[model samples]
Target: MPSLHAIIPAGGAGTRLWPVSRAGHPKFLLDLTGSGRSLLQQTYDRLVPLVGTAGVNVITGARHRDAVVAQLPDLPGDQVVAEPAPRDSMPAIGLMAALIRRRDPDALVASFAADHLIRGEDRFQDAVRQAADVAREGFVTTIGLRPTSPSTAYGYIEAGDALTAAPDAATVLRFVEKPEVDLAREYLRAGTFRWNAGMFVSRADVMLDHLRREQPRLHAGIEEIAAAWGDSDRDAVLERTWPTLTKIAIDHALAEPVAAAGGVAMVRADFGWSDIGDFAAVSGAVHAGETDLGIVGDPRDVAAIDSSGIVVTSGRAVSLLGVDDIVVVDTPDALLVTTRARAQQVKELVDHWRDAGREDLL
Candidate 1:
């Protein structure tokens, strides 16, 4: 029953979902679900009940400012926190704490990733409420998704002992990085494993306290940034300081630390959530029944050429021949031709192209 705010990290370029999704346009902004609303906008709408129009804060890169503003126009333009350099999740987490602390020091924050998909809104909102309560009690609450498959694509969390509220909720024994196929299968069979959905609920004051105690350098940098908070010349401050910040993730800098210290709690979320992290994940959402045209194409103009599998088009000419079990995505400037099984590796391909200095291809 306290003041709540939502901090959304919307800085991903979604290189894995390339061709249709590019550096200029990431996966979160696309209505890949064909739900008439984009992922980020959908998240914003869901968080509005707690964060409201003005209370929602988004941390993003300066390059994506116009795109973010275009979606959340009801929000004050200044509320958008744009990083000058490429700092990792730790800095972004720090940035949100600093900014939100200035406005409401005691505010509880419900942090979310912009690109995730969740069905069953009632269950999702209920889980958030429970997490918020735990945060008010000064515990960092993270949602642990019940793994439906032995997916090596996601990191796994071993459910620990039971809690008062969450009898089924795991204590989050240890955070595992992406595992091998065999280990992932082993975990699925073990039945106590859950995927870390990267959602965090905590108070600005409490998280700042933990960061100061645990990550001193990051704490100092963010503290300085917060002290220099509301000046009109914001771009000047970011350009001077953000590049000096470290490139650590919040999971490494904060969550893992708290997890190691044995103070974090996991809430069981059965809301049918998917990270929608790559092209394959998107395909799973858009692909329909085989006999039903099963593929979603621009009705105005879709002339299939012996294509059996699902092919989605956005008003472009798609000529598919003998393509099956494949998701062919055509964007304004790029194209992604990949099988469903290999969709998770889209980020790796993006990185490969980036390493090759093929930014245009990205």
Candidate 2:
């Protein structure tokens, strides 16, 4: 197998997980799993075995650059690429691919989001290895997680024929957006669909070629920035060219088009994974007692009396009584009180705060 480099795109405000996941400290920087390590640190831990410490790179916003570096001190300074502004995953991952190709054209690059959680490390590694192997065959490969439920929250990937070079891999037919509940159930029954976890692997050159063909202007800008990556002009070039590039996601810019052209592959991943997009997922992953009550912060600070819900405390002690299926997140500046079913709408609260001119709470 060729050498692999991992790119972790550590953007996204995680508005659904507000209060605890703020602009200054996003979901990726929080220890939502209660495992003593933040989500980004866990992601780094999972990738280090496959790509080594120096082989892993992180692309984040300029504001979060210091936090990302502080969390991953072992990562090289040059490996932490900070974007002056958010341009979505396409520009972030594309820049990383260009930089990796600058070092070694044949290097295999894999992009993983910074806030996802995966169980069964061995299975995750196996899936990534298979994806990398398929990538070496000059195909853009993604890890298609086996859907455990008809989840309307996640996008689906339709698998087509099996690859001759990689029997464990399947040609991607198309990428589907998050469907309605009824359609999601139908997809679950079909068994040919897998949840698109946004994990992608490809040769750096192959990825760049697809970008050049599909998004010429974006590709050109990244190429120019990559050329001056190690030089003194890096900052100046990135500042001037980045904002001029189109703001789009990698899935729209490369993955969807590449899949339609029969150039994308999928590796079936049977391991457990969660993007941890909201408090509901956090509740499922972390629990305080035998009940469904999930406590993210110190459990000792919480007192539950027949309450079965999620409770996150900052410093003060919280008492929950006779409340079922509720979510209470307490921080020094803000406190969130809602239910798991309404977790997806937490972003509205962030918007409301913004409109209310309470930027400090956000």
Candidate 3:
């Protein structure tokens, strides 16, 4: 097997998890699961065991570079590639792919999101190993999580024929967008559909080849940046060319088109996974469907008489009286009080604050 490298894209503000997940402190930096480690730290913990610290690289925003390094001090300073601005996943992943190619063209690289939470590390590692095997055979491989429910929140992957190189891996027929409840149910019944967790693995050269074919201009920009990566003019080239690249995601720029050409593959994943996209998801992960109130901060600071929702407390004491399904997030500067049903709309609140000139709350 070829030496595998890991690329972790650690962008996104996670506005829906606002009050707790702010622009400065994104969701990736938060410990939503009550676990001691932040999501980014946990992501590093799992991948380091597979690829080692040196093999893992993180592509995050320029603003977050310091925080990301602070969270994972063992990661080499040069390994954290900070983006000049947010252009979405395509540029970040592509730039890292280009960089890895420069280091070793034959290197197998896997991209994973830093904000996602996963359980069953053994199964996850096994799936990555299978995906790597499939990638060696020239297929752009992704680990497709077996859907436990008809989730309308996530995109779906339609698995096609099984690969001969790795029977557990299958060709991806198509990528499906997030569907309505009825359509999601239909996909669930199909059984061929898997949740697209945005996990992709491929030879570094192969990934660049696909990008060069599908997005010539974007490919050129990253290649130029990669050429000057270790040079004194690296920052100059990055700032000059980064913004010119297309603002798109890897799914549209490469995965979808590549799959249409019969070049994409998927490894069936049984491990537990969640993006923790919204406060509702955080509640679900933290509460685990239990009716009791879920506390993310100091439990001693909370006094609930008959509450049945999640509360992320700051330093102050939060007392909930006879409320059900209500979310109370008490930060020092801002307080969010909403029902769990309205958790997804928290982003709207963030936007409202932004528009209202209350940037401090955001």
Candidate 4:
């Protein structure tokens, strides 16, 4: 019956849904799920019932402090933890684990991304509660969603006999990187495979133990950062040393080693969820006032016509003809027009634009 801590990593700058999701506005801030709440807000809201106000923590970038604060006003401002810069998830997770350790070393921390949409909160919460119960018993756990497609975008977790029944637990059999289409399909057919939900739960001490066993070097650095954690002049300490921490990902630094150590376990999730990685997915869920936004082509646009899959948005003057599967975002300063399938590659396009010195468009 120890207290539970929830760590939500909101530092990712989702570049795929560009123009709409730029440097200052990542995809997580968008009302993509049309849930009336943003993805980050949804993430924050989802935990309120489970953890209470005192148990949740949101870890985001210093750049996004205002956005997060404004989005989740219900949560206390002190609950929000901001990173000095983008150092990837590992450092962010490591830092939070250390800070939380100072407060309660044996506390069970449930960590997840801030930008995912889930259709079943009850199931998700059920799975999290189950995981927390296991964490209380000293297990490092992650919730893995059942995959409906062979998505190359996600890293897959192969949980052999893990959690086959009620309150079940087993060791991780393999950690598979994003694979080729053929192999992904093969994994889908294999009952043991599960999509990495980017969700994890464990005691801070367990994670520190993981760092010591699998990634000692990163662990030592993280411990140093923890020892240095204080608010006497937190800004000064964070600014001076935050950049020194390595930028490796948590999966690379910790999950891989945990899997290697045969202690990693996953719970099969029954929630309906999506990453909402692009505008196409975002547009599918927006509600543009009801009557003011006319349905021009595609029905999902909140207003689209014969354009079955075309996402078009604008005032009364906007129109589309003979177009399908194109994402047309109409903002005053910038417009994003691209095929929905290629949306994932837009980050590379952003790099290209930056490399070409087109900061205006960026």
Best by TM-score: 2
Residue pairs with colliding backbones in model 2 are none
Q: What lDDT score belongs to each candidate, Candidate 1 first?
A: 0.78, 0.92, 0.92, 0.75
Alpha carbon lDDT of residue 245, candidate 2?
A: 88
Given candidate 4, what's the lDDT at residue 210? 84
Stretches of candidate 4 off by over 4 Å are 163-168, 283-303, 310-317
- RMSD, candidate 3, Å: 1.3
Better of 3 and 4 by lDDT: 3
Best of the two (2, 4) by lDDT = 2
lDDT of 4 by residue, 1-362 (tens): 67788898897777887766777788778765435688898888888888987888888988898889899887888788888888888878877888888888668888888998777789989989888876666667878888888878778998867453337455577678888999999999987788887888888898888878766766776777677666565667677777887788878877877777776777777687777776555544454344223232344445345554434443424555656666666655766667767767778878888999988767
The per-residue C-alpha lDDT of model 1 at residue 96 equals 87
Off by over 4 Å in 2: none
TM-score of 2: 0.98
Tens digit of lDDT per residue, candidate 1, span 1-362? 66888888886767677766777787778887778888999888888876688778888878887898998888898778887766877788788877788878788887899888888888888888888777787878788888988888799877788776544454667788889999999999998888889998888888888898888887887877877776765666667777887788878878888888876778888788888877667766664655323355564455555454446577777776666667777666656677877777767767877899988887
Q: Enumerate residue pairs that collide in model 3.
A: none
Across 24-48, the per-residue lDDT of candidate 3 in tens digits comes to 9999999987899999999999999
TM-score of model 3 relative to the true fold? Answer: 0.97
> What does candidate 2's lDDT look like per residue over 66-150, in tens digits?
9999999999888998999999999999999999988887899999999999999999999999899999999999999999989
